[model samples]
Target: MAGNAGVSKPRTAAPAASWFGALEPDHAGDSGDDGGNDAAHSRYDRGEWRASDVADSRFLSRQARRIAESGQSGLYRLYRAFVAARAALGITLLATEIAFAWLITSHPQHGAALVLCAVYALATLALWLLPNLLGPSRPTVAARLRRRQWAATIGVDLLAFGGLQLLGGLLNYTALLVLPALMAGVLTPRLQALGVAAASTLIVLLATQWNAGVAGATPLLLAQAGLAGAGLFVITLLAGELSGRLAREERTARGSLAMARRQAQLNRLVLEELQEGVLVVDRRGRVRAANPAARGLIGEPQDSSGESFALAGVAAWEPLARAVDRAFAEGGWPEEGRDVLLPRDQGPRQLRVRVRFTQRREARVAEDYCVLFVEDVRTVQARVRQEKLAAMGRVSAGIAHEIRNPLAAIMQANALMAEDASSAEQQQLTRMVGENAERLKRIVDDMMEVAPGLVPTPAPLDATAQVAAVCSEWARTVQLPPGAASPLTVELPAQAVGVLFDGEHLRRVLVNLLDNALRHGSRSAGAVRVWLGVADDLHARLGVASDGPPIAPEVERYLFEPFFSTRSRGTGLGLYICRELCERYGASIEYGSRGVPERHRNEFSVAMRRALLPDSESRPHLGP
Candidate 1:
């Protein structure tokens, strides 16, 4: 952990050198002054350096961060932009120079200086500007000018500087201002199409300088600058070529990495999409990787590195890790790896995940591992339950049928015995056997109700009239015992709720519904209501409604399910059969437990498609 601590011997990572007056920032809170240079403290400002540090994050805009991250964009675009900016500045100066030569005569004293200065600025501007313009943009204008125009344009600029130096002796020393123009070309240790600029600057400086000694030495000075610029240009060109080669190599590497990543993704997808959930963990009991289904079956991934798997509650992964560790420690699995029960917030999921030595014989690295797969056992459990129920149903149905014939025969014998009863004991026995046999007959009939496709017969009728008739008949047969007056009420829609209907089926369904209301809702009040109507003539709907006790939420859930009943006196097929028969008649029924939110009144309604009244010619066919 030593960082430039002056410990005499360095650690693994330490600064080898410093540049740009910069010293290494201290680590572990020591500055290492030793009084060698007090100014070293100022050179390295930890806080300021940290402010612009890549980890600071705030300094970079989204775009800047993206460019830094993405290897997709080449640096060529950045270089093109740099060239364009320099070119624009240089061109503006060039135009100014040509104009100034014509304007400076009025101020005759400043005339030579103005022309020289303007010309130099113009030349500098050209060197910086034109290359950017020519290289990436407008390579072929009219005919093609290519990069040759760039080199030629720079040469023309240098010659203009030279021509200006000759035009006015000593006065054109103003052109020295253009020397800084060389900085742009040699700015970052590279000069392309800029050798002429340095040569031109030297030519002007010597030619136009007033001092004879300096003027005489001009050619040699110019020769040195030209040589420097030429050498620098060669270096720049070589560096650019190297950068291009490196970029091409990097791009190829990136493409190969991308293909490998896709193949890995496809392999992972195969594991994830399987019905069996899979979790792979290392020796540390941490989830190394899992699939989409597994994440959903277990929990969402909270660990970005997938190494904190115990927190993820992936139970199967822990055992797999142990199994793999054991397999590597020994040789093979112990008892085919134990069954792992991975629990989740959803439910306790049981997985019969097993482990074996991972087949990696070809891999050069250590590869002994285990694979754990979790299969859902809920469906298997459900199927076993259904098989048990079916077996019971078959056994019960057979026993009930066998007892049915004997029960009928006993009832007939009891009737004959009642006629020959001699004393009270014999008479009582006859009545008891007959009553018990009748009860046994009822149980047998319920068993017979389980027969297949025993649908209630449907016959077309005037539904409105049929409803009225059924209500009258129910009132006659099942009335309040003696003197209690709870009137059975019947309401009907004024319009005919015509439907392609079943008369007998409607009677039987309404009878069952009325019985339910009385048995459930009217038990306390001893009153019931029946209503028949057309909810919608457009869809040909006929609706029947009854009043009863509100069906509680628990009861409402399975109210219509076959063999699901709340009544103590009868089988649960009443509501279920009613709905099935209605559907067969091209109708549907909706049952609700409350009139409104505040009131709890059990209500059942049967609705059917209306039978269309036939046309004039067709009407005669029904007349017979």
Candidate 2:
């Protein structure tokens, strides 16, 4: 044990660290005169140093304490109910005493009987009210103390009844004696219950003899009293034993319930964090629970009212609903998932829906349910594609390293052949050979671009300004006539939109998009528009849209594929290169034929990662 600052290390061995130990400081300490300067300095020098002291008891979190208190609250509620029941029994006793006293008022000891009854009634009322009136708002009284209080109260009432019988010259109050004794047996310890039984029997025996007007005790009367005491004791002991067993059972049930609740919460947390969507549905096809991923896959909000919607209700989910019906028809889970198409603004998305049925047994009945695991096909395909591309890139890079030397020699030989040709036809053949070699070289360059490990170094830049600049530079470099360039329009947001992008990579993506748009665009003003804007608040949008004729669905599908070109002269690697560069910077390039309103234009949009702007700047106005 050592002292540093005001912290004192415990003399005992440090306790084992638990999962939650990180919440507390390692060292035990009191606040010091250094005003935390020493602690701060120590923390600075030894960054992981814990400067404050914590005891083993501090391991329990606030949530754990709350859960513990909740379990105890249930026990407390049961105890209160028992107390109330006892109070109610006391009230019943008071009523019986009043009626008995009225019925026997003409007796010689009427005055004493009436007084005793009055005392008993008042005592019962107090027993009923005291528990409610006493102690703090949320009292934590011990179980032993509460039981003792009840026993003492009930004992006094029993003695009062005994005295009334003795004074009134009536027979033993055997029926009245049982009430307090039974309650004592149920609520108090075995010894206390036995004591109550013995005391009650003695009171009744004395009262019976006094009522008999006997000078001396008879042997028959003594035997009768002994028999009565034995019966009372047996009742008390058996009743108390039963009550103890019932209490133990109740505690066990409560513990099981608490454990169930904790497990359910943990299961829900795990479900919510899963990448696949999980939907719990009843046999009727109503969604019982849809996790966040499921909601996202279904194009619904996390807090959506999808649970209320039948599986067949939403038009977008019709395909999935049909798939579910087929699975349910088989009366079990399908071995393989069914693929379904969903509509999105970007394009049609593919999803795989899987079903699993669960039967829950409750008492004599069984309830059946099913869980649907919905996974996006795009995500799965993307992961598979990325793996394949990585493998291909490694092999291609090795192959390209070997092929370049021979390719270089071939091009040199073609050039030499062209120089030595004597006739125009010979020169033409050599020229064609040289041209094909150059095309092969270009294809190799494009393949190199597609190879993996091209990491983009992103920097915060104004997307609107960068895009406008790129478009202007493109038009100037193309050297188009003023009339031809007039068709190219730059539509920038009123304010600058911040985005994270590599300047060179973004320039390349924009150049390729603009080049394609200009070639196929309508020969009219504002026919080709480059829009820089924001999308979903999390991404900056840079779209190259053209008022060009709609492309065929089949053509649009492979537009971004490398070496897939429509024109004879087109290389077809332009869009593919653009996609590779955009992906390197964590951006996406998507093609659309009918996305923009009032203009059925072909668009290639690049969604760049949005950057947080400083407080000094305000967000740009999103145009209507």
Candidate 3:
């Protein structure tokens, strides 16, 4: 009885600590108390086992609670299932005893056996219906009263079976003892399970001895009871060992599942943020998953959710679908990527598509998929051009430094020789030399502006008035008619709009754009138009558009590139310098067709940062 009552001993802490030690080594030594045995006993009696006796104890309790919540949830569920099974077994045993009693009406001990079965059935039913009546459902609480619980459950089973056996019933009741023994083995520690088996053996021998004294039992009956007790011990040991192994496996599986879920979420987040388009496609040309970049590249609506589309359904994407099919047929793809054209109403777009097959663990060939890495060919070329331009800028800066001194000396010599000239022919020749020297100096200055360390110091200026003044001066210089009928048309905003830009730099950028427009536009009224307006609340737009033929595709590719020009005498630094200056003042310059469809005109527009106020003091210097 003492051994049976020891089932409720608090042994869960040792196992919980051992399992958590590997994960939290720092708290492995914590025993929920720091002062020793006396303090531990005192805290236990006061229900303060989880109190923070020390700093480590607090942290250990928290870690233990978290482990109990997540790791032992499945264990608690299994325990409840076992309890319900016990109830079902009790009801079956009761019905069996009643039927046996009805078959044997003259049996003397039938009434006592029936009464015992009914009481046992009721006890099991109550336990199952209200599990928490014994104590709280938490494992921690259950561990505290395990002895009382075992006594109430398995002890009653032993006593009831022993009673029926002693009453000399026709049905052998010894085999019925296996239920409690198995339950003890699974739910309790190994030692407790063994103790239940030993108690059952003792009950069997005592009952047999009492029967022999009362009804003259045989040796065969004694041997059978001994062998049956031995079988109970074997079953208990095996059940206990198997249950422990299953628990360990359950914990391991749950941990692995949680880690896999986290990894999948991280992979999704990274794919969504990638700049290159990623598409997962199967052999049937069905797109299983597509990232935001892939959707944009395929011209799919971003707001659409969950619905998947096929690449082969659209005519423009048929080339991509065919490429996917070819890859599947060949069992491999080119590592350098394959170019596929998507011809649209606007223009044909080129995409570099690369494929990598997924290696699935299963043997199903239909489950195989390929990941496509899509990149725009134009974007690739732009990145290459940017790198080349960086290298060229460095070389140009060095050459400009070397040419500065020689160019200054030539200009000085030309000026001095002009003063000494005696003939008008010599004077004209000196003037020509001076003009060419100045042009070379301007070119050198433009190259120097491309130096990376240059920063802009901006002040607020009226962009509307500035555009009007620059356009009027340029029209007169080009010998166009004055006033509203001039070929150079200037359109200004109704109100003065201030922009952040250096005064002289703004003038230079506007003049460069106007010169390009006039040189390319037809020499007629309203052919070259300059306009200033507000693009947005935070920006002011200045545009120079011309009624000229569309720029050739080959030339347009390098429109703003330094030293790239179509005319033999043109330097091609005008547009490049304009872009650099605008960038220095937090502005942007781009070339596009700006007019209506029938009168599409080549336009160079600058988007400048709007000033906070129309005062130079209020303007802040911009950074590049």
> Which candidate should be chosen as best, given TM-score against the real structure?
3
Candidates sorted on TM-score, descending: 3, 2, 1
Model 1 regions more than 4 Å off: 1-386, 419-432, 453-469, 480-487, 495-509, 523-526, 532-591, 595-600, 605-624
Q: What's the TM-score of every candidate structure?
A: 0.38, 0.54, 0.65
How accurate locally, in lDDT, is each candidate? 0.50, 0.64, 0.70
How much does candidate 2 score in TM-score?
0.54
User: Mind giving the per-residue lDDT tens digits that candidate 2 earns over 1-624?
Assistant: 000011211222222100000111323232222231221111111112111211112234565445344433222343455445545655665566567667776667766655666676666556455654433223231122232344345666577767876784443456667766776576444555677898888886886677667575677876887787788888887876666565555445434444555566677789999999999876666787888899888887334644545677767777777777776676655567778898777888899888876753234233356789998888888888768866866787678667778999999998888889999999999989988889878767766767766476787887766776777678778754454337777778777788888777788788888878878977576777788778877898888888888888889888887667998987788998998888877899999877545462788888889986553264444321
Residue-by-residue lDDT tens digits, candidate 3, 1-624:
111111122323332111111111112222332222111010011122221222222223455435433433333454566567767878997898889877888888788888888998888788778756755433432221144565667777888877877776677778878877887676665666787899888778777877778676689878888998999999988876776666566545444444444565677789999989999998789888889898888778333766567887688889989999988887777888999998877898899899988864354465368999999998888888889988998898889989999999999999999999999999999999999999888888988877787486788887766776666666667778765566677777667788998877888998898888878888677788778788899998988888888887788878888988788877788889998888899999999975446342798889999996544332221110
TM-score pick, better of 1 and 2:
2
lDDT of 2 at 105: 66
Cα-based lDDT at residue 421, candidate 1: 98
Off by over 4 Å in 2: 1-111, 125-155, 158-169, 174-241, 255-334, 337-356, 359-457, 461-499, 514-554, 557-573, 583-624
The residue-by-residue lDDT of candidate 1 on 521-576, one tens digit each, is 54433356666666675444333333454567887877766667765756677776
Clashing pairs in 3: 7-147, 8-146, 8-147
